[model samples]
Target: MKFAAFSGVLIDHSIQEALQLTKKLGFDGIEIAAREPHLSAATSAPRVKEIRTVADGLGLDIPVIAGYMGGFSTASDKESEQAFSEFQRMLEMSETLGASMIRVGSGGPNAFLAEDYHYAKAAFWLRKCAAEARKHDKRIVLEIHNVSLVETVESGLRLLDLVGEDNVGLIHDAGNMYITDTDYGRDSVIALGRKMFHVHVKDEKRVAEAGSPGTFVNRTKHGEEKFLQCRLGEGEADHQPLFDALKETGYDGWVTLECHAPFPAYERLEHDFRKVKQMLGLA
Candidate 1:
């Protein structure tokens, strides 16, 4: 798989600097942040041009755009309209950047209907968004985030089935699921192996008794207490099974490493990138 990095960790740096860091770390591509002071191709066309120039100058390809952040579902018409607008903006950015895919996640867990209705709403928005994406020949890879309601393997698979669009796929994150009490290392990989259009490589270490009033520590508490993001093989994330699944499914996309620990983010990011490369046998 081609390796990449998310620009969020480099929030303090410029887009060109982030791209340079990515190249130095041996990444093949990048997942640009949509919000500024980062890189939003939709809001800043000139920045997009500069980014394209830099990527071309470095011989790197931008396969994915990660600038979409407003996905909270709304029960009211006004909110829904706002959410749709945000989606449109993200799509526009994706199109401008020539990114084949855009990464997005379900908004806040405000609970949209249930069962058929839930699927209906999701399909309604996804189909509309997919139609727009099709105009630019782009795809939307929905992300499975722990804070959201639909991050589980079953939920992701069900959404894919309900949406029933080849243009829609998932951006699977191993550490996110692992921290959410899901067997993403094994089950999720098996469930959505082929449906994963992109993958985020991350791992978290559980710290007990770091804080809180409860004795029984779980994924949520453990994560909050001692959430240590680490390289692929350095944490509790089951890396071998995930890699095996990736190989079995023939997924050829960037394995973007996300750094969310307390350490100097850039230093650890480079370390994790190299670790993933060596472990994935891409080095």
Candidate 2:
């Protein structure tokens, strides 16, 4: 699998700068954060053309755009319509960015677990979006995250079933799975199989005393442990098994480097990039 740098991690840098550094660091591609302070829906047409030209010139692929269209779990009818309108614009942006997939989160408040959550409403919107994406020749991916509807493999599968769109898929984010399911990540990736259209790479250290009253803590089956974001190979997660599993599935795609370590942007990204190369034996 090829490795890419996620622009969100480079919050301190402009998109142009982020692209330059990603190429300099030996990443095969870049994942743009299609959100605030980066490139919102209101981003100008000229700016979109600029990013596309720069990425192409750098020989960098934008594999996916991490969009802000969280599912309509709790949005009002008007809000859902608004979100759909916004997604259409994002699809246009993603097309120009040369992204094959558009990443969508489970909208609304973060759920500690997948149970007792009414995902039908979310499914409705996902189905609509997935259908729309197909028309654009794009795929929609939902991240397996802590606060979202698809926190576990079972839950994620169920949601996909509900959406029932062929182009709809999941993003196996190992760090987020650890926080929500205490999963080492290999098993989940194996379970996802071809349904996993994309991935976000991160290694989170378990923090025993992270936040008060489980604000940021997940009452995982193991226990309530806070997951502290850290650079790859510098945290509790062992990515070798995860890498092995991805290859086993014949997944030859981009795995974006995304972490929330408190280190400087370039330092953390470079560190994770090297770690991924080492684990994959690319170095």
How large an RMSD does model 2 have? 2.7
| TM-score, every prediction | 0.86, 0.92
Inter-residue clash pairs, candidate 1: 34-67, 71-107, 72-107
- Candidate No. with top lDDT: 2
lDDT digits (tens) for residues 174-203 of candidate 1: 887776766776567677767878888777
Q: In model 2, what are the clashing residue pairs, if there are any?
A: 71-107
**Span of ten consecutive residues with least summed lDDT in model 1:** 213-222
Residue-by-residue lDDT tens digits, candidate 2, 112-191: 44444458888888888988899889999888877667877777888899888989998888887767654645787878
For candidate 1, report its TM-score.
Answer: 0.86
